[model samples]
Target: MPLSQSEVLAGLAEIVNDETGISADAVALEKSFVDDLDIDSISMMTIVVNAEDKFGVKIPDEEVKNLITVGDAVNFIVGAQG
Candidate 1:
């Protein structure tokens, strides 16, 4: 079954929190990973890898660059699951 946006968001929040030590509550659809979350590129890659494993979705490096906001990542993961 494909994950819903909120499901993916919650999962991604956990992954982000695990990687960056940021509060999962801080993660929201409008937040930018870099500007809002202050996630550097290295941490972003780690989060991406973990998200792939947790969500069973493949996020290409090219696509990773395009995932600017939290919602973007969640939407990508949801779409990729299909």
Candidate 2:
């Protein structure tokens, strides 16, 4: 079965936690990496790399920076897979 958007977002939260040492639960759909998570550019890059590895797809930098929410990441992954 295909993963749901929430599931993908949850997985992304886990990946983000693994990379940034933050709590996965803290990442919400409305949360911004800069304002909410206080994530730096390097950590964001790590997120992009980890996400690519996790989803087996390359996320372009433009898309990476635009991922402001869990739903955004989920949508991106779904689109990439499609």
Residues 1-82, candidate 2: write the lDDT tens digits. 5566787788889988998888999988778888888988898898888888888777998877788766677788877863
Error of 2 at 80 (Å): 1.4
Q: List the candidate 1 regions with Cα displacement exceeding 4 Å.
A: none
Candidates' C-alpha lDDT: 0.94, 0.82
Residue ranges of candidate 2 with Cα displaced over 4 Å: none
For 16-80, candidate 1 gives per-residue lDDT tens digits of 98888999999999999999999999999999999999998899999999999999999999999
Error of 2 at 40 (Å): 0.4
Compared with the true structure, model 2 gives a TM-score of: 0.85
